[model samples]
Target: MQDPVEIGPYPRKPPVTIVDWAMLVLAIVSVIYLAWITFWHVSDDIHRTIVYVDYGVCAIFAIEFCWRWRREGWGWRFPVRNWYEVLGMIPVTNPAFRGFRLLRIVVVLARLGRAADRAVGDRVTAAVVNKFVNTIVDVIKRPITVAMLDEVADVLQHGRYTTNIANALEENRAELDAMILERIRKDPQAGRLKFVPFHDDIVRIATDTTFRIVFQVLEDPRTDELVSDLVRENLDQIKESVREKDIVRRPGATR
Candidate 1:
C-alpha cells in the first residue's frame, strides 16, 4: 500500500493591512466626534460641521461594509448580523438615536479583537470554548438505538446522500482501481505465485469452488428462514433486557 500523504498546515489569513488600521482609527474618531456633538449641545455652525463630518464617515463605513460583503461572497447575512452599521448610515436628526452611530466603533473593535485572536495562536482559548460547547451538547444529546440509526441511514441512503456518494465513487473509480491493482502487484506472495506451474489454473479452480459454495448456501431454502429466525430471537431478547432495566430503574420499583 502507498504511504499516507502528509498534509501541510492550512494557509494563514493575511494580516490586517495598514489601510485597515487607518480606517479603524478614523471610525473611532468619527464616533467620538458624533457622540460629543449629539450629547453636548454645540453651536449651530459647529454642529453642522460635525454632522457633515459624520456623513463623510458614514459613507466610508458604507463603502467598507459593501467591500466586505462582496469579499464574503455577497451573503445577505453579513448585513443582517451587522445591523448597527446599517442603522448608523440612516440619516436621523434625533440625538437619542444618533448614539447608534457609536455602535460602529463596537463593530470595528470586535473585528480587531477577532483578528488579534487569530494572529496570536489562541489555541488554548479555542480548546476551552470547544470543551464548554461540547459539554452543553453532551448534556442535551439523546441516546440512540440501532433501529433509529437504521431508519435514519435508510432515509439518507435512499435520498440525495446516495446520489452524492455514487457520484464521488464514480469520479474516483479509476484512481481506486489503480490503487488496488498496485497493492496486488506489491504483495510479496504475488511474484512467487506467478512462478508456480499451473498457478492460473489453481487460482481459477479455487475461485470457482468458493463461488459454488456461496451459491449453494444462498440457494438452500432454510438459509433465509434460519437467518430471519435468529435475528428475531435476538431482537426479542434485547427488548426483554431493555424492559427489565427500565423496571429496575423505575422510581418506585423494589430492589
Candidate 2:
C-alpha cells in the first residue's frame, strides 16, 4: 500500500522499519549492557548506571512502537505482532527484558543479506551474511542468551512461500506493463530510449529465479548450528575466565 503520509509532491512509504545506524548502535549498546548484567557480577554503581542508560533506550523504543501502532492501524494486535520491540520497551530499567534492541541486528542482517543477493550472487551473499552474523553474535556471544536463530531463519526461508507473491504479480501483470510503459515514455531521456514491450514470461522467469536463489540461501541447515556454536563458545570462555578470577582471589594463594 502506498503511504497515506504526504510529502510535498508524493506519498512516502511508512516507517515500518526502524533499522537505522543510530537505532542499531543503541541496540548494540543495549545488548552488550544486557549481557554484562546477565553474565557478569557488577557493583551497585555500575548497575545503576546501566539502568539510567537503558531507561532512555526504553523510552525511544516505546515511542517508536506507539507511532507504528497508530500508523499501521494495528490496534490492540500491534503489541502482540511487534512483541520483539515491545520486549525492549517493557522496562529497560529492570534489565530482565532489555534484549529488544538486538532484534535490530537480525532485521539489518536479514535485509542486508537480501540486498546483497540482488547486488551479487545468491550463494555468495548467503555465505557473507552468515559470516557477518556469526561475527556479531560471537562478539555478543558471552552474553548471547537466545537459542532460536534457526527459528527466525526458518520464518524467512519457507519453501514455496512466495507463491502468493508471484500469483499477485501475475494477476497484475497487465497493469504493471502499462505502468512501466507510461513511465518510460514520460522519462526526460525518452527520446534516446525506446520502449520495449515487457513479456509475461520475463516477469515469471525473473520472480521465480530470484525467489529460488534467495530461499536457497535461507534454507541452509548449517545456520542453526553456527549460531549455536558461537553462543556456546562465548559462554564457555566467560565461565572459564570467571573461574580463574575466583581462584586468583582465593586466600593463601601465591601472588
Candidate 3:
C-alpha cells in the first residue's frame, strides 16, 4: 500500500506566516464575539448583526453539507440529512428540536476528526484490494479444486444413467454403462457371467459423490442448485453406457 502523507507538529510561529496567524486569531476572536453576542447583548443593532452573522454561518454550513453529500456519493437515501443542515434553514424544526440539532453538529465534528486521522494513516482501498485477491487465491487453489474435477467426472457419467426411479425399472435402462463396460472388458464374462445393470446403484454412487465434492465449495444459492443439476445430468449419462453380460449371465448383469 502507498504510505500516507504526514501533516503534524504544526511548526512554531516566527510570526507564523501572517496568513496562518490571521486565521488563528480570527477563529479565536469569532468564538469570543459569538459568546458575547449570545449571552450579553441587549441592543437592537447588535441583535440585527447577530441575525445576519447567523445566516452567514448557516450559508457556510450549507455548503459543507452539500460537499459531504457528494463525498458520500449521494448513492442512497438517508433517514436524516444532518440535523444541523435542517436547523440552519427550517425555523420550526430547529426551535422545536434545537438540542437534537446541536448534537448532530458534535457528530459532524467527530467525523471530521476521524477523516483527518485516516488521511494521515494509510490508503484504505489498497488493503481492501489485497484482501479480496487473497481470498480468491485461497478458494481456487484449495477445496474448490477438488469440487471442480468431481463435477467433470459427474457430467461424463450422468449421460449414461437413469434420471428417475420409474425410468430405472420400467424402461429397461443401463444405469452403470461406463462402470460395467470397464468391468466387462476386464472380466471378459465371455460365457460364464450374467450381467444385469442396476440403475439405482449407478445413480446412488454418482449423486453421492457429486454432492460430497461440491457441498463445501459453493455458498451462493444459485450456484448450489446449478451444481446439483449438473450432478444429476452426469448420472443420466452413466445409465446409458451399460450393456448385458455373457452366457450363464442373461445379457446385462453388473456387480
Top candidate on TM-score is 1
**Tens digit per residue, CA lDDT, model 2, 1-255:** 977964331111221233434454565567677666655789889988988887787777567557657776768875654444454554434655445445544443433433333334323444654569667555565433333443343444443434544566668766866666566557788523444455444544655676567555545556545554566566556567755655665578665
- For model 1, residues 1-255, the per-residue Cα lDDT tens digits are 999976322212332556455565665576466556646778888877776776676677678768768877888886765554565564343354454544434444333333343454333333444669666444433223444434444443334433444466557756755565466457897746767798657655655565456556655656655654555566556656655665676579986
What's the C-alpha lDDT at position 51 in model 3? Answer: 53
lDDT of every model, 2 decimals: 0.54, 0.53, 0.43
Clashing pairs in 2: none
Candidate maximizing lDDT: 1
lDDT of 3 at 220: 42
Cα displacement (Å) at residue 18, model 2 = 9.5
Candidate number that wins on lDDT, 2 or 3 = 2
Residue 2 lDDT in model 1? 100
* Full ranking by lDDT: 1, 2, 3
- In model 3, where is the ten-residue run with the lowest total lDDT? 239-248
- Per-residue lDDT for 1-255 in model 3, tens only? 989966333222332345334433433443444445434635777656655665554455455456556766764442142432343332211233333433434333333322232343322323443569666464444334344445566564444332343244334324544454456446655313334376446545765565445443343455546656777666444433322112224336445
lDDT of 3 at 166: 29
Return the TM-score for each candidate structure.
0.33, 0.32, 0.24
Candidate 1 TM-score versus the reference: 0.33
